[model samples]
Target: MNPRNILVTGGAGFIGASFTHYWLNKFKNDRIIVLDLLTYAGNMSNLSQCYENNRFEFIWGDIGNSDLVESILVKHSIDTIVHFAAESHVDRSILSPDAFIQTNINGTFSLLNAAKKVWIDTPKENNQPVIKHRFHHVSTDEVYGSLLPNEAAFTELTPYSPNSPYSASKAASDHLVRSYLHTYGLQVTTSNCSNNYGSFHFPEKLIPLVITNVLQNKSIPIYGDGKQIRDWLYVDDHALGIELVLNKGKVGETYNIGGNNEWTNIDIVKLICSQIDLKFAENSYLREKYPQAFAALSGDSASLVRFVTDRPGHDKRYAIDASKSESELNYRPTKTFEEGIVMTLDWYLTNDDWWQSIIDGSYLETNSKYMII
Candidate 1:
């Protein structure tokens, strides 16, 4: 069903912002209400273009707040909810698990309860049930934990074995979603996606961290041997996958979304460096424009790679088997890793001001702190 009134939590964050833009662009008639706490990672600038559209509205709030969430649901007459709000970083979760538990677990519970009250308890036009309501929970493949080199990729049926606090919290939330589906009959669908990289990604992530650090001639830190592998999905492709599941997927079903592009950590970093080198060589204007940044690319940017201690309980490898999603929903990622990385590099290179603002702490409060491991 086409969702007319939708609420997207964490719409100011990276993947959330991308999904918000994609949803607005795809469904011109639909209205989207974004609820975000605007935390350290949530940036308003990510959704700058959304302000021009009348169908878009933003609310600065937390999902853990039950009264606020319920009020927003009733006010907007929301029929669909695409939840993305969570404390997602592994390193941060390792340092402080309280936020992860609060935001990922408790916050999800609040959302589920609010959705139940609105979509199940409250009647619609003729005192009938809310027939078309859906809650699409955005989840991570990390919930499946690490896979051996010989093990098959994680599928929808993969059992949960979350490693870190972040993944554990997400696993708990996923369980809550499933319980609500079986016990309360709340219409719900879940998608556990692989690592996402592309535009508007926070610099704390692997891809953006490498790109930003390389541009600034800073050391590109690699954890352990940097051989840990991850299946990488472009952010835009992930957004599309979510939309497909929201509209075409069956209720109470889980879909695995992936780019089918897996690369080791070191390989990804070196590839980015190589791409930067080629870009600087090809574009004279780009080289002339940012001399220092360009000069940092004079030699191989890979020379800046620095081996660092790996974070505790780091997953060895994660791959996805999205055959179910492909056959059932006809979903497939369009961009290969090579193509997506180029687009990602070009975006970072061109949007210097965006990353610069982040580096300069313009968006973050003076006292704000982040676990930048």
Candidate 2:
């Protein structure tokens, strides 16, 4: 059944904001209530267009607050919860793991407890049948740890072998979600997606970091030998995959969503540089439209590449076997790596002001302290 009232946590962040937009556009009759803490990564500007829609509402809050989550769920009569709020960056988690543990593990526990109390316990206490509710948890493939060059892609049955503190916290949360399903019989679904890149992505991520750094003529830091491979899924396609799992997926099941597009770190950066070169060469449309932005382009942006120390517990490769999601939910990525990268680059070039705010430290004065790199 289509969700009528949905609570989307982290709706101001990159992938969450993109999914919010996608859902509102696709389901006109549906209402979205967004809950976010406005952390460094959460930018209100990302949801500026969403504010104009009457069906959308934004809440400046955290998922760890049980009272707030319960109030919002009950007040809105929310039937679905798309949990996305968390500390997602690996580097930040390396520097400080406290926030990751607090937000990823404790926060998920609070959300699960609140959902159980409101949707199941309350109804049963009132001598009524359990309310139909869905708690869809958005997760990452990193929870399965690194894959060797010859190893098969990660599937639904893959054992949990998280490496870094970040992945460990998320793994703990994933287990909590599973336990809720098995013990309480909460109607829930989970999707562990590969890396995502598209518009509204924070500047610290690899793809956006490279694009912004290249545009500003800054050094593009590559960790170790830059051979770490990741399956890159377009943000919009990932949003669609989540939507499919929410609507068509069987309860108490997990789905793996991937782009089927794998590229090494160095290769991805080189491609971005090459695309920028082609776009700014001679009298291209992008060059003509944004001359100032292209003025720094020397058609050799890749020269800025600098090898640096790799972070601790860096995963070598992560690939997903999404056949189950493909066959069951009829979900397939529409854009190949080539097409999605072009679209992503185009968006970054055209929407400089959006990311500029983050770079200039004026977007949110409070968030400035959390800015890394």
Which of the numbered candidates is closest to the native, going by highest lDDT? 2
Candidate 1 lDDT by residue in tens digits, 14-104: 9999999988998989999999888888988898899899999988888988888989999888989999999999999999999999999
Q: For candidate 1, what is the TM-score?
A: 0.95
Query: Which lDDT tens digits does candidate 2 get at residues 142-243?
Result: 999999987999999999999999999999999999999999988889999999999999999999999898787788999999999999999999999998
Q: Candidate 1's C-alpha lDDT?
A: 0.90
* Stretches of model 1 off by over 4 angstroms after superposition: 1-3, 124-127, 365-373
**lDDT scores in order:** 0.90, 0.91
Off by over 4 Å in 2: 1-3, 282-296, 365-373
How many residue pairs clash per model?
0, 0
